[model samples]
Target: MLLKPGRGFFFAIVLSSVAPVAGATALAVDPMTVLIREYSRGNGSYEYLNSGTDESYARYILDRPSSPYANIKWSLLPSPDTPTRRAIESVSTQEHPVNLRDLHDMKVWDLGFTKAHIASETFRMPQELRYVPGAWSIVKAGIEPDIYAQAIRNQGLEHPAMTANYALAAQLLRAKLAATPPSLWKIRGLRHDVLDRFVGGEFMLAHDFHYLIQFLDGALATWDAGSTSAYGFRQLPAPLRLGRIAAAYRQRLPFEHEPCMEDDTHDPEHAGEGTFDRRPLCFDDATDRAIHVWYAHELVQELAAIHDRANGAPTLAERMAAPLRSSRQGWIGIPRPSAIAEVTRIEVVEAKVTGQLLVEGDVSYRDAFGASRRALRLSCGMRP
Candidate 1:
């Protein structure tokens, strides 16, 4: 019987690292049977296992410790009768199996898959959906600035491995930023589409993954813009548990962009086949909403830092120079599009516990058109 579409109903699951089960029946049996046996034995928790090619299994892994089957374990054998073996057989028949190995040798700019996947008539899986995280993606996941901030606010101390991951991600991001002709990075502008180029061209996975990637890319972009050095960002988190939770969820955390609207609206099982409506997009989804809130809090903290630094200067010259100094040497590390000549005034309109902050101010800056003063209004997830 086809299981009802739930967190994990096998559409396709990719299994890697199949370990040998110690003792099991030689006869072929369904995976559900093993699941039942374990449940019957009253094991409250079991090891997580990967098998199959369907998204039910993929989404199950995407949900992680939050999923009902989070603790369950099932192993696959060389025998073709196993569910995992069947999935491998199934994927082998598909014209486009979600494999990154095939695309590795291709240059990021020359990648044809991004346009191809977007233009395809039928839905195809993106690389972010893979249960086993790609080496490129694992490195990309650790470079998140907000993740570092979250680590600071909630915990102070990163796992050695996570620190290593973040450090690697920073190094790669810097290399990518530096190697990129200034023109291309400007063209990319820190968006989801950059994943196609930046993280190794793979199919667009989930909108949530794209959303998070945008944030990380933006952070690195600031580094490129001379806001702060990589070493400076590391200094802030060196004492905090920045990557401890991430360490527990390593590899998994990077691809956990599930519960995204793309799955809800586009997947045949969830939204009904051929009903393809992109209108119910990421911004409307619950998970993305929470992420937005987190980003909002981070923004408030950033703006608050700017306000405190600029307003605290004892004299007008210092006050006017405060923003520029902060931009160059401050801890907040946000990027500025143009150099600030002076911050004339700052008024905090509102600050809320819900992670919303509103501030409006008069600012003077020189750009290509020359210097001018204007009122700048800043709000989390809002403008004007």
Candidate 2:
């Protein structure tokens, strides 16, 4: 699903609802601009740069209604070989001045342009129209299974690394559950090293394990907060409040007596060298960390369901079907596409059309003054 085209490649998204209108010609559109077109009307914002930074450009056309650059149509990715494309790409010898195309290679803000001129700068989406946050607030906006399911369905494909990490986590979870004297968790520093044998080379690949620690830290803090906290564990039935188990899992995740930085398993030079500082789980592996987090998250939900079964509380599967949301943080990212489309047919057409869609991205480009470059992060979508 990851598309990589030449410098100015076309990305077309055809949804089932708009399939008839889009016709056979898959609209060659920049996903980000499509989002801005859908939601950046009254939601856009504008802020001027510091003094001496294109006062004329800011004063004249920035927010003015008559300015074409301020218009969403003007902000779109111009069709190939068109006058608009030619004009925008003319001054710069580099890739098309399409917004956000140079994101990864952006220059630091402190280092201003080597040469400065108005014509020297390239055309990109203006800052005002690229501030769409509404797109992110939707997937979880509706009720259960609303947009959240669609997101995971679209974006949740697993790679080999992810699969291996999840397998490791599953093995560890199984071993932990089978350990003798389950009440050992009541003793804070007890070792649950049943699956420590798996903590070797392959385990080190999960670089994002710290996020699991972070989630555990939040769980502990919430539990400690008691009834006063908005997400207080005390609000839950006593059986569902897994405070001690979480603490034990946190303690057992790393070497209890060792410092994280000095842990040799995570250190490149000393990794898997059998150093005393080596941990059962390296806190830095991204895939491994995500598996651990997913494991722990689902474990807690299952435990809660088991405990609350008698009281007719929602089961783990029921909760899993619900959209991703939080009382404290509101909507969260879950569903993949956020906007869905069905491809009815494939045939070449010539006209441009906007279809229901959602795409979020960050674009880095130098300002019109050719001064410092900055990033524009936005979430754009047209919900079905």
Q: Which candidate is the best by lDDT?
A: 1
lDDT of 1: 0.25
Residues 30-50, model 2: lDDT tens digits: 332322232222222011121
| lDDT (tens digit, per residue) of candidate 1 on 66-101 | 221122122121222233333333333244341221
Q: Which 10 consecutive residues of model 1 have the lowest summed lDDT?
A: 107-116
Candidate 1 lDDT for residue 128: 40
Candidate 2: C-alpha lDDT: 0.22
TM-score of each: 0.22, 0.19
